[model samples]
Target: MDRSKQLYEQDATDWQRGMYEDIKTTFRAPIVNWYFRSLTANEPAFTRYLWGQLKPLFQTRAFGRYAVSYRDTVLSAIEDGPADLPRYRRADTALRPAEWRELRGQLATFDVVAPRLALTFAVCDRAMHGDLPDANPEGAPSTAPLPPWLDRDRGQSVTMLEAGDVPGDLSETVDEIRAFHGLEEGLPSIYRCLAQWPGYLEPAWTDLEPILESEAFERGCRDADAVVDGHLEELPYTPRLSPNDLAEQGFDDETIDDIQHYVRAFNRGAVSKVLQTIVTYAATLDAGGERSL
Candidate 1:
């Protein structure tokens, strides 16, 4: 982690609280992603510029339609053993029906949109390079209910547990999640949620490594990214801001561009990383969330 960038959640600023809430609501996720967090940690205004362009596009009904369609396609497109998903899911009991529904919906949203997010980042990156992404995104999905589990009161993501913070038996699972995923930032937040159920976490660690390492999973992710690429038109984007625009706001071009490129790259690949993680976790929930913590 760069000292200049706030890579961890503890480094968040006050403004980020509001942004995190809004972004979570918009994205239907349990927490804000590290990519967005690091960007804001470095420069708060970047959130406005970066997400402003992206937010509108994502908010559209059309984008939602494509997202839903793409998710369905990718889920089936992969050859990763669906046969194994049943087994991985067999060991759970924490969440009730609505909770299970909430968890899987949130996980699926990330999984289904994984490829498009990668493309969107590429589009943003090209704009920085003076190649614009198309402002036109089409399609409409009816307004759907978001997962109630993301609610701060009734349901919250269990605070992410550090390896040392976990019970001795569960520590290795955290290590493998980091080692196998090759994440520079250790485990993503969702894994900690699994830590609450040791039985689920134990088997889940075994299930994920092979599936993520498989040819079918890689092919599915690539195909999903391409599908979104085909559906999109690359239009010119100019940093979503300029030297003057940033300077007037008490920032500089170099920092803004640096943040843009860094975050764009972060976002580009984040979908698959998150998808690989969440779906593996969701298998248990999908199998009906049967075990108690």
Candidate 2:
């Protein structure tokens, strides 16, 4: 299977599409993330099993609080920093009122998904490193229902521009993003989507680039990692998708290695930083009130 290939929602089988719906519903967001789509593409069975293994992590009230805290911590980090994030408005950009609203809502969606991805990667990273959580901790977090207010349909469907689809003038912007995220090629879905609105993406990146490079952003990443770790410590139950666990479940060594490779790619430095950056961008738009948009 091509690691880069993804079984997007439209191309998925009926059953696979149903699983995607389950994921969206469980995550309380409208879109399936790229990580899961990639996983499903490469190995649907393993992806399904992995979802079952990790679903418990997201279902608990503790995880809900963790998600909220993760967003707050990222925002607080930005707020506490010396440079203020430029709060761009509809009037400031060339987008029509509807387009501006769509941009804000789309970013708001990313805000909701960011922390969830953080927790996903953190759990996978720890488990793969042979530091599995205790199945039965002495004082586990509550297994109560997730909070009702947690991102219930807050974002619109996510769409992104293909590499060829990106405008020529925005080449500098694309290159800067690729360089910042250390990508040899290709932009992340978030940036690709933002690229559809050059009016916003260009200026926003101009203001955001320097701040993302600052020591302050680095500190925020560290602080956000700590917040994720703190919540992982409070997990009510362990996730059973470690390498050993996968082997026991009859996955081949090659399959295990492939899983590890993908997990490490997303769980490493760049994904988390991008996740936090998305949150910071979304929070800025959110401060002005989504209703007014």
The candidate that wins on TM-score is 2
What's the TM for model 1? 0.69
Candidate 1 ranges with C-alpha deviation above 4 Å = 1-17, 79-84, 87-123, 136-158, 234-251, 268-271, 287-293
Worst 10 residues of 1 by lDDT: 284-293
Model 1 over residues 79-182: C-alpha lDDT tens digits? 35454443433326455665544555554444433434554565556555554544542322223332333212323333446644677787777777777666
> Which candidate has the top score in lDDT?
2
- Please, what are the lDDT tens digits per residue for candidate 2 over residues 1-293? 46578999989887798899898988777889989998899899998988887877787777777777777666667778899978877878879998988898888778778888999998887787677556543333347767676678788888788988999999999999989989887778788888889998898889988888887788788888898888877777787877888889899989888788778878885777888888777865662212110
**Per-residue lDDT value at 79 in model 2:** 72
Question: Distance (Å) between predicted and true CA of 116, model 1?
Answer: 8.0
lDDT (0-100) at residue 30 of candidate 2? 82
